[model samples]
Target: MKNFSEIEAMARMHHPDLDARLAAHGHLRTAQEIADIPDDRWLSTMTRCVFQAGFVWKVIEAKWPGFEAAFDGFDPVTVSFYSDDDVARLASDERIVRNGQKILATVHNAGFVADISREHGGFGRFMADWPASDQAGLLELLKKRGSRLSGMTAQYFLRFSGWDAWILSKDVGAALVREGVVDKPPTSKAAIARAQAAITAWSDESGRSQSEISRILALSTG
Candidate 1:
């Protein structure tokens, strides 16, 4: 398998088209590199994923400000305190998803965020206690948390929000195949090694955010 630096050089050569795809997705950060985003951006991403559960990210991006306003900037303290009337208003907002179920889930998730915050003194702390630094743990957490629009894809989105440290989802590996970035290598250690090399290279130069990487990787791979 190629080392990371060599892979980076190869990927940089192929990065122009990849970069275009990510820009179309509204990605503004580097891949798998979430060290600079602030707390509010993280919360916004979480809330936007709630809206984007079954929808497209571009659509969500277009109405993001509406979401921010409807959810009171995704402030757990403010959103968790939403009244029934507030729910009704949000559910009718045309600029947002306007789906009652998704709207309620966002409210419920806000409260859930509050609960996790109390239990661990902060939601970030709670996420840190998660076992298994892989997609399986993310899947189990989504299932247990009553996430309405969550699945493997959604879990990956959560991981992109800095909720996890790695992208161990099958979809992530499959993305390499879709992009023809890697051969249809066997699903053995060798194949995984090739995929990891591709990911490291892609992450280094594409200037895509993790969520954008997840989206493009999954779509292209599929």
Candidate 2:
């Protein structure tokens, strides 16, 4: 039930030399900023996060230009139409990572982006319209609708794309447990709900963005 100021005070206690006042987390984008993003860029970032999951990020970074070229700049409409032949081609393509499952996930997630775009005028609009207070709901949508977006990928994509969100990284989870929000990492539906509620309560109590809260908690507990 501690507010952000209290947590920040705790953080300052932990690291006395560093100023503990919450700076805006650099990674999160404002709603207007996120709304201005193109659908293609969204798809591209989503694809990158998907491929980067459980894999070396620098390797993906090194090959991103090839990924962009191979996927035709991640045009959602274009990639949504990729066929079985395209899957086979990408699987053997040296330009990008050769994981078959991840390659197919790109195609599926492209379709997901297209669907959301059509439903909400654009994917950017869909993202922009999502209330930050209900970030867990958006994460659930990503998990149910998108491929290879389970666990941390969706959160990473959100941060990378400038959407404000809390990343339940291992450190963040530990921080949550440390705060008595839950006794362990939130895995089951009930535990996850408890975690989200704890964060939402903190957001209300502190009037801070999820990104700031996440970093503050990480600093204090990690």
Candidate 3:
């Protein structure tokens, strides 16, 4: 396995300029900072990632107020029960992005939020209880339970919601292969497990957040 210092050095070599070294790094939100976020925020972030998956993120961000108003602040209980009429209405709503599939995903994801809330007393509780080392498991739940939240969408949801997530970006995938962790971007459970194990070990050895480790790895091959 490659060390964090080795990865950082590679990034530095790529950047070259002395000041560029510090400019190339990133950080993660601590669990304590993330644990107390409102349940609605979690749903909102998930929905945003869903919408932004194959679309322009800035367009979504610019229209987010419309999205908030259109979705009733993304209240899980309220959204989970959205009627057929509601779906039809949102399909034409000019205020928010009008992608039918993504709009419908909001309703489906609302049910997902409600289920987690019931299981954990609230989605925030689930976030607090979930261990970062087991993020691979959390990814599984997001894919199976959350609507449209598979692959990078699931990862971006966690990352945007302040989890110290490891993104399997193309560059990060290359770094993984270089480090002998995996031969390709992980798709199956076993592949993801191998990726997770290597990341967890790197996190422990480097004392870095998964986000930082992910960035370092991605940057290593850039």
Clashing pairs in 3: none
Off by over 4 Å in 2: 16-27
Summarize candidate 2's per-residue lDDT along 1-222 as a digit string, tens digits.
Answer: 566688878877886743434443454577888888999999999999998998999999999999999999999999999999998999999999999999989999999999999999899999999988787888889999999887789888988898877788787888888778889887766777787788778877887767777777877873
Where does candidate 1 stray beyond 4 Å? 1-42, 129-135, 163-222
Sort every candidate by lDDT, greatest first.
3, 2, 1
Report the lDDT tens digits of candidate 1 across residue range 1-222: 334334334444556475565456443333324434443455666677776766787998998888887777888767778899999988788879888887777777777667767776666655555542233444556557745635544555555565533343566565566556556632444564555455545555665333554445544433
lDDT of 3 at 35: 63
Overall local distance difference test of candidate 2: 0.85
Q: Give all candidates' CA lDDT scores.
A: 0.59, 0.85, 0.85
TM-scores of all candidate predictions against the true structure: 0.58, 0.93, 0.93
Model 2 residue 186 distance off true place after TM-score fit, in angstroms: 1.0
Better of 1 and 3 by TM-score: 3
Task: Give the winner by lDDT: 1 or 2.
Answer: 2
Whole-model lDDT, candidate 3? 0.85
In model 1, residue pairs whose N, Cα or C atoms come closer than 3 Å (at least 3 residues apart or on different chains), thus clashing, are: 178-221
